[model samples]
Target chain A: MKHITDFTIVRREQLGQHYFALTLRHPGTLPSIAAGQFVEVEVMGTREVMLRRPISIHDVNPAENTLTLLIQVVGKGTRQLATLQEGDTLNLIYPLGHGFSVEGRNPLLVGGGAGIAPLLYLAKCYKAKGVETTILLGGRTKELIPVREAFEPYGKLLISTEDGSLGEKGMVTQHSLFSAAYDHICTCGPTPMMKAVGRYAVEKGVDCEVSLENMMACGIGACLCCVTDTDEGHKCVCKEGPVFDALKLKKWMGIE
Target chain B: MAKLETKIHNITLKNPVMTASGTFGYGEEFADFIDLTRLGGIIVKGTTGERRQGNAYPRMAETPSGMLNAVGLQNVGVENFCKQVYPRIKVIDTNILVNVSGSSIEEYCSVAEQINELPNIPGIELNISCPNVKKGGMGFGTNPEMAAQVVSEVRKVYGKTLIVKLTPNVTSIVDIAKAVEQAGADSVSLINTMLGMAIDVERQRPYLSTITGGLSGPCVKPVAVRMVWQVAHAVQIPVVGLGGISCANDALEFLMAGAKAIEVGTANFVDPTVTVKIVEGLQDYCQRHKIDDINDIIGII
Candidate 1:
């Protein structure tokens, strides 16, 4: 069940130049969070910031009831979140939105830039299910690539940077897996990158899902703020899914 | 116990606190965050006569103290609302008022008649003040004739309480308030999100997808209080005031401004439990002042 509970910041770290991860330890057993699911984090610096920030769950420590959030400091809310340290109890609505499905034998997870956060947990889930896992993580430069070591143990790791600053010097779609055989595939990145991956999957007839990052308020279906057009019509990204089948989206099919 | 009871015509809400329409989606969504029955009332989302696809994406944009939305009444229409939403909300033990909106007076009456069939729903707030839609939304509320026409027409078939929610964009809101009252409206609620817009200078475009949207939050509180006070004085019906009310203290201002009750709107986005908190705050304020009746504070200023 989803809950609004107090989570103390167990630790905090800067994954790279652009991303910071805040690990929150819940007071009780942590709810089981699937990949692609997110949490609404209440930033506590000031009363002026009226809404809670919706962030994807970066990683989870179930036994200790702690969860990590990957926040990119692009605005005031994230900058306030980056200011917090260990021991401060922050409130959170845990395990929100729909998560990824791990039903395939061979699964390839692709992530671009900061969108790699949720994919790590997704890689771990697929690994636990005994599926062969491979992750192709991308960034603009080597310095922007987030925590690489955390993902190394979960799957076969691949990297791409635009400046040849890291591994292969190009987008994640440039990886051989872009055309490689896989039973299922998942991608989360900039919309154009996701759309590109969607086009490839459609051509290859591979099952693919993409997590959308629409601006949200209420972090629930009630507000109707974060809606996306799909084959079934408009759906609240906060509820029906932040993770959606690539084929169901109108944009993925090159229609919208 | 303090008398927080509020009666408009024959219907009496347990308290003068209602989750405003649009902000509170069908009352069922906030169920997990707070208890539904504890609220004074729940004004579900705007429902029209037919299922509405609403406006295009990029509907809501946030501001410093408030937010702007161009959702344009995206709902399943009244028929689907009755079938899909009504059963779930009907179980909640509180006043559930459907905010009725439409492109025409016939549309308003058609939706109201549907709500009239639902047994648990106590009333319908004729939403003539929605500024987000392009058609008969705030257009009706801005004009006294259109406002009265919808109210008078809905009042004919709908036997329950008919509350007219007026827009703040009008030249003289008191005229619209008086018109609705004369049309047999049981009560009136004020200040449904002031018409406003924001711009993205870097992108050189409008902030909201609709070019403009309804501005709501703490910034609009003073305007809401002023309008509620003026309309309460101009009309004899009970007044329900709302605009950027984030806390109990904010709600007190509206009550003192002669509003019989108050609705918490955009504040719910900030704090889902704010209504219950305001309910508690009102009681605490009454106790501190040694005032046994909550209604005594109305128009105290």
Candidate 2:
């Protein structure tokens, strides 16, 4: 189910100068949201910005009717979003796109930078189901990775920073945990990192689903702006998926 | 309550607020967010003779108060639309219009002819103004002769209301509007996204897959209103105005400029329920002004 409604900003926690966590409370009960689903948040109070920014579900507390968006100030939209304070009203079209399917006994969740937002909710969902989960997050530097401690309770958290300022250094794909065993791989981050992880999953004969951060307009299937080429044809990332199986993704498999 | 009912040729709109082609999908996508029947009309995605893969990735780029899209009219094609899409969307009670697009006159005729067979579809919006496609789309729309030729050809087969969508890229939008009107178009909608481009300063590259894409949003509203006003004064046929229409005030501007009906475009992406809100807003505007009919405001400017 999807919802297009206003959510009041109950909490605004600045993770860093560029990163912030917006915890929004819906006036009504929050819709049933799955892991990897995202929200298209209207970027208000900005003159130049018109399109609603698509932000992944960082966390959702249905009991409290709250949803959290971990946004990084990458452009005008997110920059305007960062300025939103507590009690501000933020309109959102939420729980959009197909989320990651909880399959396989063991899952390895990999995230990088703001891409890590969705993975936290995914890990939380997988953990609640009693599925074993491992999270590997990577960033250029330690500061790039925000809210690392949140995933601690859900799974075994692994960190990789290029500057060696955090856990064992290098790209996330270069992390030593690659040698360990995981039945399925769910990774989101920069395209290159997801591609590397997709390639590794294919080679190891493991099922993999990677979330794509494509440029979108409608955040629905209508616009067809955020389409990703796959063996099946052009799929709208906003509708069919922001998450896709590695095998079906032609670019991820290096087939295209 | 104000009379929002509007007529475009034989087809009647419940109100003047219709969803723009390419933005509203099949009307089912927005069923969760808004009531489908509340809209005056639902214009589905552009239907071509065959399936289009559309442009490559990065087909969209956000500009100041607007966005650029080079979607290239990606759709399931007319055959699949009749087979797979029509059956699904036909149940909606409001007026349903198919946005017919093609690279050639024959393709346009073929798609329009097929859509004409659907009993529930009230009309077809011949998309001669799609700027993204490499071939026929805007090519026909840019020239007076080609635009009239395509509309005349499609008009032969399409039995119902025919709305010719016009691009704003031309020097004289009225000339193209009059051409289509002379060629037997029952209505004309303008301006179908002004051609524009944006560049990412950081990457030192163009933002969209196609260097230039159709620019839409509130930034293009004034131009659209001007074009609608121009075409309304020039053409006898009804003028359907669109482009950067986000709210009721923008819709009112078009109505005042001479559009009998209006379509909500890029704003649908921002707020899914904007079309209904505009419909309600128009009612509020009418009630506030003590106007009995929305038609009274048409061409007031």
Give the number of the best model, judged by lDDT: 2
Chain B alone, model 1: TM-score?
0.98
lDDT of 1 by residue, A1-256 (tens): 6678888898888776678988889887787889889988887767567678889988887888888888888777888888898998888876789999876888888888778889888888887888768888888887777778888988888888999888887888887555658888898878888888877887778999888888888887878888888887788888988999988985645855
How does residue B233 of candidate 1 score in lDDT? 88
Model 1 lDDT tens row, B160-255:
988889889989999999999999999999989888898989899987789989988998999999999999888888999999998889999999
* lDDT of model 2, residue A142: 92
Best by TM-score: 2
What DockQ does predicted model 1 obtain?
Answer: 0.63
**Measured against the native two-chain assembly using Cα atoms, what DockQ does each of the candidate structures obtain, in the order listed?**
0.63, 0.90
The complex in candidate 2 yields a DockQ of: 0.90
Model 1, A103: alpha-carbon shift in Å? 2.0
Global fold similarity of model 2 (TM-score): 0.98
Q: Which stretches of candidate 2 lie over 4 Å from their true place?
A: none
TM-score of each: 0.97, 0.98
